[model samples]
Target: YVTPVKHEGVELNILPPGEDLEQIVEELWNTGRPGPEFRELLEKSGAYNFYDFIIIDSAPFFDVRYTVLSIYAATRYVVVLRPSIVDSRRTARMLRRLMKYAKDFGLSTPDYMARFLGVINLAKSGTIEADALLNLKFTGVKPSKGFNPFKHPSDERRKNLEKSIEGLRKVINFSNYVLPLNADISRLEFKEIIKGGKSDNDLKNTTENLLKDIWLHATCQK
Candidate 1:
């Protein structure tokens, strides 16, 4: 009875109040087994078509059972590994666990483990900025050109954010799949991007770049 919740939407309780699991199971069995009905319900609820790209964000320790089930059902699985010893070790352990689960379930073995895109050295640290991370081959989302937002209120931030966008675009081209979102989608807060009275185009470009990177990184696996 795992609930499928949509991002940026209402959260529905998976297990209803005062529901007895044993009674529900018995009732379902009384109806001559409910596998087909359950499958139809899953499809009819729009959970099947909610998004072209579904990201299952698991906890650091990876104890969630439903997430594991979803990963087995997914066509692609992306594992993000930081360029560090500790993160690499944790990722290896997680992959081992996933393989063990697949074997236990008698699922077919995955092909091409490296096909799952590995984004190395993500995020910035200390005085290092986004551009610095990009220079180190870390895929990021930033403007393309140089524009002093403080000096030019009407100027766009597209120039400044293009490099990261280009890097992400390359990855998307490699993956051969466009995102389900519109080109003008932005996930940033207005306060952060609109400082010094910047144009909306900046936000639009940033959003597009962000979405592209998210999809590319998330679905680049086998």
Candidate 2:
């Protein structure tokens, strides 16, 4: 008896840690690989047809090639961030940059915000960082004007405060999916995956809310 094949998840045609990515960069330079061509590669691979969503984990902001290419290729974005002040500040800056790029590409203001789903609520329970960020979510009406963290160079204390305020402002705008930081999905057992036995209510709810956001923002009719 033959077992039926299932669409488990993604197929990662991963490049080894070498100059393969660099070679692609050179090839693209020669043959005019536009940034959106990354998305084209995805569609051509047949994976984009198979999966409802495709998450591209690119290198950090240091890698300009993968970073810009991924952003250009992505239809929408979800920001999963580390629970720290630095990440928060970067989030604010990054969102602004993405918006600028979209507008440059002819997206109107009303439709521009639609490109982002929401940020993951990665606040760890009882942690001070989580508490501080959560305060921004609950208390602030919006980010204070001129909340740029890197503005004040002379005063270290003021700079730190600016960073916190900026981070707070960004989270207030994007906090929708509540993923409890305690639920360590990385170490989940294989049986748990197959049977879906262990249930974390937070994770489940987060998954649902995320799907709801996708539905609300999606142009494709399913």
Whole-model Cα lDDT per candidate? Answer: 0.42, 0.53
Clashing pairs in 2: none
Q: What lDDT does candidate 1 reach at residue 115?
A: 30
lDDT of 2 by residue, 93-169 (tens): 66665565665447875465556544544555554444444444422112233343334334354446436655444
Per model, state how many residue pairs clash.
9, 0
**TM, every model:** 0.40, 0.59
> Model 1 residue 153 lDDT?
26
Candidate 1's TM-score reads 0.40
Residue 168 lDDT (model 1): 35
* lDDT (Cα, tens digit) per residue for candidate 1, span 84-194: 345555655665555544443355544424334444334333212333333333333342244232433232332333333344333322222212122222454434443
Prediction RMSDs, each to the true structure: 12.0, 8.4
Error (Å) of candidate 2 at residue 189 is: 6.8
Residue ranges of candidate 2 with Cα displaced over 4 Å: 1-18, 26-33, 36-53, 136-175, 189-203, 211-222
Candidate 1 colliding pairs: 142-161, 143-160, 143-161, 143-162, 144-159, 144-161, 144-162, 145-159, 145-160
Off by over 4 Å in 1: 1-46, 49-55, 60-66, 81-84, 101-115, 119-122, 125-136, 139-187, 190-210, 216-222
lDDT of 1: 0.42
